[model samples]
Target: MKIAIVVKEHIETKGGLERYAVTLSRGLTARGHEVHVYANRWDVDESLIFHYVPCVKWLNLLKVITFPANARKHLAKSSFDLVYSLTPLYPVDIYRVGEGIHADVLRARFPNPLKRFLKRLTPKHRSILAIEKRLFTKGNYRAIITNSKLVKERLNQVYDVPFQDIEVIYNGYDDKLFNTNTRAYRGNLRDTYGIGDKEKVLLFASNDFKRKGLVYLLEAIAFLNRRDIRVRLMVVGKGKTAQYKRIAERLGILSQVIFAGAVTDIERY
Candidate 1:
């Protein structure tokens, strides 16, 4: 069967939804489907024959609502049997990978003002969410894929959609890269950063710190330090770096915190 996957870049790596898009496309291709990915013009994957979407973030939020005009046009132009949409905050059909729907996990990790507001207002906050909800629940999909059971259950409850619609598929870590044999790679990474073997390494990885409870983690680390746990935090990610640095400075733990920005390599983790 021919397949079309719609996705967008959420980060260089680590966005579960983005990973799902790439993963699903590759998997389907392996099974002999003619797969095509539809994404923002900025996204590049020559190997996968990625089609650039007409709409992108720079134009404005208004474009977000109306500019998918091109995507709709593109879909009508295709005769693919299946379309799997890896949600980049837009709606698509047949297969989807819903993310972070566990209320407990959301509460623990993303207790931020904006996230809180979005959760409460949901479809009311943006027309996109409502569009997504309507398409997902009402679409003619042979199967839907979700990353987690919690998310699958939440999708059913939220939209009152059939529970059988979603199939659970997980995001994978590269076992080859993360194996014990990767010590050489890890050592090289550590040496590049001049990180000492004796320093208590508090490795925090996230694209957004505020949403991931970086402040709470820092505070908890400070509390741990009073008990003589001299820790050094390596924050590997993209957004709000300056805000986190300021918070560290205010806590007088600036020396202990190292904002590593974004780095590539499985060993770096």
Candidate 2:
């Protein structure tokens, strides 16, 4: 079977969605399917065929729009038994919306009515919403896959996509990289970071630190500092850690907060 996987970023990119695409493509290839990946910018993998979609780098919105547009055009020129899109692309056999609905995020995160209204009015936000609506409504995708029940509910609540049409498919990770076998590295990792054996370690890992509530985590660590129990937080993943570092400093838990940055090997800690 010939299959095409569509995503904005390269499968080799370090993120939940990228990992999913890589894993899915590898799995499909192992099962005797020829997999082709379509992306705007990608880290190359020899096992799968890659089709690049040209887009302007400066205009973020244009970049988002161009990838799908080019990918669709490419798809029209080519033929595949199955077209699976991780993004909200039109006319795909399957749409896997691992990234939750942007509408829901806007509404939940920004409680201020004025802010929400203004944010919705933005070009990027409007474009995302429009594409999502089309993907759910007129695209006629055979199936809509979500990473969690919350995502499924969000789809139903936001776009009125039928609950029956949304299938909850959880993300997969490297089990070997996140297993009990990594226990040996725990002490070494802690010691290397100057963490005492008695100190409790809290791990917060996310590429987008702000969205993942890094500030909230630091505040929690602050409150926990008041207690007799010693606690330390190891922050992993990419983002401007300087702001979070200031936050930790302000909370007087700077020593306790270790900004580990983006780590490829997660299970080691």
Candidate 3:
């Protein structure tokens, strides 16, 4: 069957969504389906997008309607048997990807006017949220998949949707990359910072450290140190690095802590 997959960006998402899209796209290709992906050019792996469009950057916004417009045009011409949108973007046969965390945040934080403005400006995200909402009231999809049961459960709670319509697909790990072969992995990581083998290593990897709870992790480390657990925390990746570092210093764990900024091959760290 011919298919078209659409998404907002191609870059690896810190969350599970990136893995969701990549794995599904690859699987479909391997099965010999004609899959044409419409996505942002920033995403790696040249094979995924059969058609490239500017996505998520400032200049692309100048032609705000282009991505969806062209996506629709391509879908119309292709007469795809299935249009599985990785995001709740545009009108599609299916929206397999669920809503982002910002949904809960917006409901709590933004007033009506600001939220309405955001709705107008970036209808793609809001459209996904609306689709998710409709999933409760309508069961029209061939299938709707969620990356986590956590997300599926959220849908059930927020939308009063039954679990039957929402299928829970947990995130998968690339076992080859994460397997325990490399002491050189954590070893060089520890050695580079003079961390003793005896010292405990705590890894924190997040582009957005705050949401991933890095500060709280540091505090937990401090509490542990006060009680004499003797941990050597190793923070990896960017985003609020300075802030987390300051917290480490203030907590007097600076000497015990190492900030290894944004290692691309996280396995090495």
- The CA lDDT of each predicted structure is 0.66, 0.83, 0.67
1-269 per-residue lDDT for model 1 (tens digits): 87777765422355546655666666777887788877763345544657766664555555555445566667777777766666433345565655453344446655686786666464423555555565565544556777788777777877666887778877676575567776666666667677787666778887767667899988988888788788888888777888888888888788888888866653646
Q: Which ten residues in a row have the lowest lDDT in candidate 1?
A: 97-106
Q: In terms of lDDT, which candidate is strongest?
A: 2
Better of 1 and 3 by lDDT: 3
Q: After superposition, how far is residue 203 of candidate 1 from its true place, in Å?
A: 1.9
Off by over 4 Å in 2: none
The residue-by-residue lDDT of candidate 3 on 1-269, one tens digit each, is 88888875545544446556677787888898877777755456655546665534454343445565566666666677888887544466676654444465455334477765676457655554554455336644566677777777776777665788778766677777767775657667667799887877887876566556677888998899889888888777777777777898999998877878766576676
Model 3 misplaced stretches (Cα beyond 4 Å) = 12-16, 42-49, 59-74, 93-101, 105-141
